[model samples]
Target: MPALNIDFSDEELAELRETAKARGVTLKSLVREAVTEDLAQRRALAAMTAVLRAFTAEHTTAFDDAFPDDAPTGARRRGAA
Candidate 1:
């Protein structure tokens, strides 16, 4: 596994230390878990974006027709149709 180096402010470091202590884990373990969770979250977001892009690309024409061309010119609710 690769090692990561990160920098935090004094107050942030103090908070991390307190949080780790409260969780009964070492500072290093807490940092590792945070980094792992962040990376997983980023990957999940990337996957979702890719899927949305692919879906739109595949259905551009039909998706466009799903709405009416005479939509309220600006952002206004015309009337209760």
Candidate 2:
């Protein structure tokens, strides 16, 4: 596999090294895990946004009509008055 080089300030590098040592992991492993998790979170958010947009496009009018101006205010459980 290819390798990548990153530059960090002395303070930042020291902090990362300290955190990795405290976790009993190498700095590379710690950084790799963080990057992986961030990418996954971003992908999940994008997917959720797409689904919401599609649902809104398909149901905007129906959703609006279901809650007309005189809709009741308080909360109610299923099959409740």
Candidate 3:
């Protein structure tokens, strides 16, 4: 695998080293895991946003003022139980 070169302040390096030691992994592995998880989260969010946008466009009238309760779906609206 290709090596990655990164620069960090002494303080930041110390923090990273401590975190890696706490997690029982090398700095390289910790960074790799963090980067992978971050990318996966970003991709999942992007896909969910795309789907919501498509749903909104396809059901414009149905959703208009239908969710007056701005809360999540499980919550009841103002006049509904």
TM per candidate: 0.73, 0.76, 0.75
Cand. 3 TM to true fold: 0.75
Model 1 TM-score?
Answer: 0.73
Model 2 Cα lDDT, one tens digit per residue, 1-81? 988899999999999999999999999999999989999999999999999978866765566568655443444211135
Best by lDDT: 2
Better candidate by TM-score, 1 or 3: 3
> For model 1, how does the per-residue alpha-carbon lDDT over 1-81 read when each residue is reduced to its tens digit?
887789999999999999999999999999989988999999999999999978866765464456657344433323323
Overall local distance difference test of candidate 2? 0.80
Candidate 1: 10-residue stretch with minimal lDDT: 72-81
Which has the higher TM-score value, candidate number 1 or candidate number 2? 2
State the TM-score for model 2. Answer: 0.76
Ranking by lDDT: 2, 1, 3
| Number of clashes recorded per candidate | 0, 0, 0
- Model 1 residue 77 CA deviation in Å: 24
lDDT of 3 by residue, 18-66 (tens): 9999999999999899989999999999999999978866765455467
Q: State the lDDT at 58 in candidate 2.
A: 74
Alpha-carbon local distance difference test for all models: 0.80, 0.80, 0.79
